[model samples]
Target: MYLKSIALVGFKSFGRKTELAFGSPIVAVVGPNGSGKSNVAEAFRFVLGEQSMKSMRSKRGEDLIWGGSPGLPRANRGAVRVVFDNADRLLDLDFKEVVIERVVYRDGQNEYLLNGTVVRLKDVIRLLAGANIGGSGYQIISQGEADRILNASPKERREMVEDALGLKLYQHKKAESERKLGETGVNIDKTKSLRRELAPHINFLRVQVEKIEKARELKEQLAAKLNEYLAREHAWISQEDARLSEEIRMHETELRKLSESVRAARGARGSSSDAALAGLQGKLAEREGKLAAARRESERLARELGRAEGALEANNVTVEAIVPVPHVRNFARELDATVSELERVDDIARVRSVLQDIRSRIKSFIEGLSGAAPVTNEEVKQQVKSLADSLARVREEETNLADELESLRKGIAEARESGFAAERDLVALEASVREAQSKLGGVRAARENIAEARRRFEEEVREGIALVGAAVHSWEKAEIPPGALSEERSVQEKRRRDIERLKIKIEESGSGSGEAVVKEFTQTKERDEFLAKELADLEASAASLKDIIAELEKTIDARFHEGLKLINEALKNFFTKLFGGGYVDIRFVASQEDTRIGGSLGRGARAYLYRTHFFDDAGESSALPRSRRDRRRAR
Candidate 1:
């Protein structure tokens, strides 16, 4: 797949959203210095999951975003997106086109999206790898990058060539395999250590297993005895169940007979009592009516006799003439006339209530004199008080006038009462009402007595009826209800006990005796013994296998170095041709594993040469080329 277009927003010098389109094979991005030419390369790196901020020439994530310049305001985010045309199925995707976008926020958080769906950076790397456009490969080249191939150390140069030749994937696989192999080695060591620790125990288990076998035989004998005992217990339980059922039947028969007898007794009592109470209530009511009539007759005769006696006593008494109480005007009328004529004195001051205020002020003036200053007597405060009291009194006078007007209205009504016949009729009617009141009081007393008697009669009847009904109901309930069959409780108890005993026997067979311990020992010992045999067989098999793997890895590693050397040679030649004239060569650095500490092994050698031409100038004296010891000797 080839890149089709790229978009940059707030990334480096591309402050605004910028889009660049590319054609089939190659697209050259050319611009003057600081015109965002390199920014295009950085954009590619950014979208392709390059995470090295240092390599991108940025100190912090925020540096990638646009900060406000003189003409432009700062943007909150930086983003780079690259679109690819995958019509040739160069990438591991079914789509004809793919878009990869990355955005960096000022807050140091980042996001990546693949085809508008958010994904991880690793996904982008893997996708590029599938397209044969991996990191540090020949697909992308910079100005210095082309020359670096020949200048790089043999190991680094080899890695570069391997990347181009598609060996990088294999190397990655090998590294991953080595990592897993290391972990497996650790696990194997731990397993071996465990086996060593268990060796003594394994021997002990073997002895235990032998004892277990014998114990198991003994357990079989015990289980047989237990089975025989259970059979005997079962027979005993069956016989006892029959006996218990027979006894339960007898008790149930007795209980049933007793219940019937109790029911009959209760029914007889209820019938006899209700009849007697009914008859007695009718007789009592009749007697009560007769007594009430007798009492009434007695009261009537007594009232008549009292009237007769009063007349006789009146006739016997001599009456002196009490001169007709001369139409004495009642004191009420006298009081009214006196109040009306007693003082036609102008009550303006009294009505004004100012007289009370004047008296109050005179009293205060005297009191203030006792504490007065000679120059300005404290009477000023007292005078203020007097004025306030006068104002209040004047208000009171107005209130009193209003009250007098109301009193005048009442007096007018009273004066009119003297000629009101309806009022006189009402008073006469009231006197008759007093007489009726006395009769009503007597009638109320009679009603109260009747009510109390009726209450007592109802209470007695209700209680008697309830008591009799409760007794009857209780007796019926106590009678034996049908379908209630007693259980053979003893038989059930025996069966439960047998079950419990059988369970206990099973547990005893499993754990209580040496048989169980022996069985455990046998199983454990057998397992370990088998493991030991298997381990021996595995060790033997692995011995040859380990040697083969070691030899194979060594061969592969050697061949890898060889192929790497060949590629470096080719890369150097390609670079020399591409540059036209550049004396460039790669040097090899041996691994630490091949180097001796005392420098027994010589310094690494150079193999690849990228030389367009080599010319020696006679006029220029060549620097002395000698070993360090020879140079020191000459000095």
Candidate 2:
């Protein structure tokens, strides 16, 4: 695989997003020195999982991003992406094109991604390994390391050459296999050690587990018995609940009908009483008005009667004070005798003569009374005259008073009748009110009794149906109310106590103390068994890895010898072409010693080769022969 395109954004020199597309092979990027041309190569290294900050020409994440120019804004982050053409499937991905990206923030945080999916740096490195690309491979020969392979140590040169020769992928595989093989060996040892440690515990748990199994069997039997009773009780309660609910409903319905009747009766009585009361009150008010009129009349009659009596007394005194004609008392008899004598004289002449004679006598009497010392003073005379007139008026008033007294008597009798009628009607209305109150009291008493019964029944239903179980304890809803159960509660209580006691006994015993102990025992046994199988699998894998390593070593040795032969021939011809009469030869070292420090292993030497040349002039001192002391560490 090869780089097809590159994209940079907010990088050290590429503040604005920039992209480069390479459609042809052997694309070269040339620019003046210090013109950020090297950044492009570093960008590739960054995208391909280079972790060395110094190598990217940055000491920190923020330094890798643009620090702002004269008129440009600073970037908060830097990103670089490189795309590869993977149509040949040379890279280990299922895509025609693979894009790898890296981003660094000013806060020293960084991330890697593959085709927009976030990934770790190790994933990117592992993916690129199969493509024979590495951070220090020959695919990217930076100017500073133009001859890096030539100067690299034996091990370092081995890595570089392997990439150039397309063997880096195999080496990576070998490394992974070796790492797995080593881990397998460690796991095998741990399994053996763990099994040894758990043996005593497993034996102890076995004894306890046997006891727990027996307890569990007893528990199962108890649960079965309990469930059977609960089921029966549940069914019985359900049936009885329906019946009780129906009965209660009927009772409530009857009570409601009775209550409605009572209310209706009350309404009727209230209307009747109200109407009666209004009529009685009106009659009472009317009678009171009539009584008030009667009282006023009585007072007026008494005042008139009193004034008449006073005037009559004064008249009597006046009559006495006046000198009455001396024959006034005898004159009334004389007049009566003359009127009788005139009646005896039937002749018209004789009758007229008799009336004249009577008139003459009355005149004689008045003249005699006036001449006799009667009213000799004019004042006395006027008084006597006034007394007479007053006496006449008094008589007239007395006549009028008698007639008025008769009418007042009639009015009093009518008012008495009206009062009696009102009183009788009031007494009847009061009787009705009392009767209605009595009926209302009885209805209220009945309603209270029924309401109390309903309350008691509701409480009984709530208590009778409540069921407590092992897993759940809450009020269970029934569509309708239920009646009390027939089964004695004592039997259920006894069974419950038995269940509780059994549970307590299990807790006291060492076997099934708690759920956690059972879980631990089961998990521990499973883990021990799993470890045994894992140990067998790991041993098998370790053996297979050893065979693979041996095969790889043999293949590498034979190939290395053949590669040396071919390179020696090519160098001989290349020296002849460059300078006449020159010979060159390359040969592999026989063996290498692994370095050690204080009995601990260090770096191992990898088989490599050196080239020799003879030009007859004998110059350049054998091209500075390479050795372990002079070689630097590999990239």
User: For this target, which candidate reaches the highest TM-score against the unseen true structure?
Assistant: 2
RMSD of each: 44.4, 26.7
- List, residue by residue over 1-635, the lDDT tens digit for candidate 1: 67789999999887888999987576677878889887788778778887889757798899999887888899899999989999998777889999999999999899999899999776777677655565663555666886666455444555555566555444444444445445555655665776777777767755665545444444454344333333333334344445445544554554455455445544544565445545545444443443333334234334433543353244442211211111112222332332233123234333223333333433443343234322121223223333333334334433544455455445444434432443454455455455445444545554455456446434533432332222222222232324222344465356445544544444544433355556666676666666666666556545544454455445545666687567557756775687564433333434444322222222342233221222233322222212354357647
lDDT of 2 by residue, 530-588 (tens): 88888788888989987776565566556555665666688788887887755766444
TM-score of each: 0.38, 0.47
Query: lDDT winner among the candidates?
Result: 2
What lDDT is reached at residue 252 by model 1?
51
Shift in Å, residue 301, candidate 2:
99
Error of 2 at 30 (Å): 3.7
Candidate 1: residue 38 Cα off by (Å): 3.2
